[model samples]
Target: MDFKVFTIIATIVNFLILLAFLKHFLFEKVSNAIDERSNNIKNTIDKTNSDREEAKNLKIQVEENLANSKLQGKNIVEDYKGRAEKLFQDIKKEASNEAELIMERAKKDVEREKEKAEEELKKKVVDLAVILSSKALEKDINEKEHRRLIEDFITKVGM
Candidate 1:
């Protein structure tokens, strides 16, 4: 290389000026754009993580609510079963009481019928005794014969 002092100095100065211009205009714009893109990517990642965490919390809350609903359903079913059992018992007790009343009424009716039959029999016996006494008086027997007749009548009534 033939060393030219003025040309070499001028080329070096020109190259430094070009580098300064590229740094100020092109490199600075490219770096700013890259920094903006990096910031946007970081913000997107953070938002995605936050959203995922929120979804997890929501899932947990929903599961707890479902468990509570199941417990409530079981309690409701148990309450209905208890009510049904109580109703069945009440019906059975009522039926038993009705049967007892019917039996008691039937017993009273039987007693009334028996007493009525006894009254009718006693009335018939009294009428027959009165008729027999009148016929014996109409026969006009002697005292000893009358006594014998009365004794025979008494024995027939006893039989």
Candidate 2:
């Protein structure tokens, strides 16, 4: 094993020069590319996070709008129900008033009819009394004859 010191020194110097050349040209460009790629990946991740947050906010807004629509629908239904109930009550009251008016008219008609019948009855009684008086004057006012006249007058009045 012959150790040559000058040759070893020359090889070390050559290795150092090759390392410096690679670091200045190839290594510098490769490092720049790696840094650019890392920055692009970080920007993409940030954009994705922002998009996800925006989607979540939009979903919340949609849910709130849907809830509001449902509440409005319920309110509309209740309002219509109230209107219908009021209309029904008004109609019922009007019908009751009409019925009362009809009953009053019927009562008045019945009263008028009863009064007319009573007037007719009084006139008939007066005519019968006059006939009895004339017959009594033509005959005598005896008890048996008077009783017979009353019986005939009663039978005629009944018929």
Candidate with top TM-score is 1
lDDT of 1 at 80: 100
Writing each residue's lDDT as its tens digit, candidate 2 over 62-156 gives 99999999999999999999999999999999999999999999999999998888767755664566567657577545645655666577668
Candidate 1 has a TM-score of 0.72
* Candidate 1 lDDT, 35-66, residue by residue in tens: 99999999999999999999999999999999
With candidate 2 superimposed using the best TM-score fit, by how many Å does residue 34's alpha carbon deviate from the native?
4.2
Count of residue pairs whose backbone atoms collide, per candidate: 0, 0
Q: What is the lDDT of candidate 1?
A: 0.83
Task: Quote each prediction's TM-score.
Answer: 0.72, 0.58
What local lDDT does model 2 show for residue 7?
Answer: 95
Task: Locate the minimum summed-lDDT window of 10 residues in model 1.
Answer: 122-131
Which residue pairs of candidate 2 clash?
Answer: none
Model 2: weakest 10-residue lDDT segment is 139-148
**Which residues of candidate 1, in runs, are more than 4 Å off?**
127-159
For each candidate in the order shown, give its overall lDDT on alpha carbons.
0.83, 0.84
